[model samples]
Target: MTAARTPLYEEHVRLGAQMTNFGGWVMPLQYSTIREEHHAVREAVGLFDLSHMGELRIGDETLVQRVLSRDVTRLRPGRIQYAVLCNDAGGIIDDVLVYAMPDRGYLLVVNAGNQDGDFDWIRKHAQAADAARNVGREWALIGVQGPRAVDLVQRLTPSDLASVKYYAFVDGTVADVSCVISRTGYTGEDGFELFCGNADAVRLWRALLEEGRSDGIRPAGLGARDTLRLEAGMRLYGNDMDAQTNPLEAGLDWTLNLEKDFIGRDAIMTSRQRGLARQLVGFKMLDRSIPRHGYRIVSDGEGVGTVTSGNVSFTLGYNIGMAYVPPAMSEPGTRLGVDIRGAAAPAEVVPLPFYKRPHPK
Candidate 1:
């Protein structure tokens, strides 16, 4: 299958970015270097083209409440909540952001790769045939992340950004382009994610880059995005968890509201009563090897679990990764080993989110 190009494709080429195929879309891997981009977001700011993410517009409140793990009725308009979509068997289908629009409908921002499958699954369970609409291709998502992100965007808009609390959104204009200015991000930083029309993507992208030049803003890509998210202790869909993985074992129990009746609630309750065999936990390398996905995790010379996500944390100057291990071995400071080419590279289980942004004064 041919990979689709985003509206910023030409701009990425013009900037000489390294392009790679991600989730059926050709996206920038890095503009200059992954380390540089990573540091830019940590210290200053970085812009991203997130057009490949899927957007589903659903008008049926009943369908929304049935599928989402969180109680959507409590999600007020202009606010967003992070939740997961689960199957009847208590396995996660996808992790998504539920945005309650002012118009009383809901917008689900899902992973690019699972967009089609998610649409099919939701539509299959919808009370009305036209309750869900796939609007991903018609929109573009641009993420401006970092310490200076809010200020950089404030210059281009007349909206009161100060009042736009985190996880909240407002319909406004930026660079004279209409947008749904949302205060949310993946990089564990203070930032805003701007949603605009596909035609306005290039313009919005260029305007942000130009305006942020003085603030040490750089166009970041998937490579930097991965490391930043890892340091922030954020989970990637396919890497951290999947259709076969339950949210309970993934340390996402907070996303589930057992009080409300929803899809997979019964199975999830059953799993809770039955007990989990393994759990996901964070670990840092004690030896000099970098952990990679699918690496075997060992304890007492036995293969115990598998590494899900691993990388060299640029900010901390250490190797960090996440893996699923037995409940007994999941605590911080528990010693373990990562099998690296027949060698047991020593590692220690640690609390997640190796890095956290300092609070603003």
Candidate 2:
């Protein structure tokens, strides 16, 4: 395949992984069975190879609030914010989290597939504003996620991991490598994403594995990653959203600060004022079938839309998917039909986040 392989490629190979291409990278799809791996993360802890994700550091004291569509003037240093990088039309170019480090710098972690594109977009906007220069190829991303992820990570670092809050991170070290451990993850459970120099990835990975062995934390692959994120109700970039859809229609208006003059502000306003033609909603299959993407979505007798994302909820023991449909049909308790294979499969519009957090919300 044309995808790049991570440093952990040999490790995954030794562990007998089913490799697959994801975002231009040859990564592991699953180490064991997807369901077993999925439950491992939900019940305990799991390690993930996230080196393919893009890492960009911002250069400017005011760069944090300046670069993103959101106004982060009040954002403090040593913190992180989940924000969307939008186009001039307000359509999401990519969704990323900004880590405001204490050195008057901000670190941006973007999706692997959108790595180069995200950097280019940010640079264009920053160049137009004559602000925010991107410091390129500086760090590597390593994600250690699961229920006991914190427990395993704390043993490696000298500082207390308890201090880090959800969506927040701090400068720290793992196995003597300079790293930034962020208390964030895509999986439903609590976890951390570490930013370290490229040379130290192997050391960090080995150290984490050594510490997590007894805790049932295995080297999780991309297969578990998908099932885990799907259960969390988090939107996958290209699958759940794209250029044709805006944040408002994707059920992510809360991420946008309409009060500010964002890049896509006008387009969002126009779309809202005109009212949305379609809405994104979650559904549960009433039959024993997996709702794959591109499956036809129908209500009554006609096809309304196509499924953007679909999966069997590993934690909930049900097949689920997200699809765009008429606003009138986007309500809980509404009945719909998913065309699984060539047959119409009965389905229902259930509340989003079909899988619940073990801990109270």
Candidate 3:
């Protein structure tokens, strides 16, 4: 299959970004270096082209509530809610963000790789209650994230950026292009995601770079996005959990509304009643070695679980990772060892969100 390219593909290349295949899309891996881009977002500001993600517009709130794990009825217009799409067995199909558009419809943003499967699952269940349109191809999604993101973005748009609270949004023109400016991000920082027409992507990207030039904003890529999100303890859809992972065991119970009727609710409820054998937990390496996916985690000299998402945290300058282990061994401060190559490297269970953004004064 031919790999797809975003509207900003040429722009990335022009900036001398290293390109790579990601979720079947050719995207920028980095413009300069991964570590440099990582710190740019952590300390100052960074821009990202996220046009590869999928978007579905559904008109029916009832069908939306019935399809997604979160209660769509609870979301007021102009707000956004993070949710999961589950299969009949209660395994996650894809984690998504449901945006309650200012009017009656809702927009679902899903992972790039799960776009087709998610659309099919949603449409099959939606029937005639809603119209599901794959609007991803027509859109360009840009993320401006960091400590100074808001100040940088506020300079170009007439909309009141300060009034837009976290997980909420407003429709406005950004750099003269109509857009949905959303105060939502994956990096656990104050940021905005601009959704605009594909034709306007390059102009918007250039405008942002120019406006933020004095503020030290640089184009960041997937490599930095991963490290930043990992530090923030945000789960990557495929890396952290997949169709085989349930919300309860993946440390995402907060995103589930069990009282509401939805697909796979019964299966999840049943799993709750039976109890989970293992649950996801965070850990920091005591040794210098970084953990990788599928690395064995041992406790009491026996294999216990496997690492799912692991990385060398750029902010903390240490190896951090998340994995599933017996519920008893999931507590913070529990000593564990990870098999790094042939060595049993020491590690210990730590709290989720290895990094936290400072509160605004």
Q: Can you give the TM-score per candidate against the true fold?
A: 0.99, 0.94, 0.98
Candidate 2 residue pairs that clash: 29-223, 90-264
Q: How high a TM-score does candidate 2 get?
A: 0.94
lDDT of candidate 2 over 229-348, digit per residue (tens): 877777889988887788887888777777777677788889999999888899888998888778899766689987888988888888888888888989988888887766789888
Residue 199 of candidate 2: its Cα lDDT? 72
Error of 1 at 88 (Å): 1.2
**lDDT of all predictions:** 0.95, 0.80, 0.92
lDDT of 3 by residue, 1-361 (tens): 9889999999999999999998889999999999999888888899999999999999888889888999888799999999999999999999999999877799999999889888888889876834688899999999999998999989999999989999999999888989999999988788999999999999999999998999899999999999999999999998889989999999999999999999989999999999998899999999899999899998666798999999899899899999999898998999989988867899999999999999842
Q: Superposing all C-alpha atoms, what RMSD in Å does each candidate have to the true structure?
A: 0.8, 2.1, 1.1
Candidate that beats the other on TM-score, 1 or 2, i.e. the better one: 1
Tell me the deviation in Å of residue 1 in model 2.
8.7
RMSD value for candidate 1: 0.8
Q: For each predicted model, how many residue pairs clash, with residues at least 3 apart or on different chains? A: 0, 2, 0
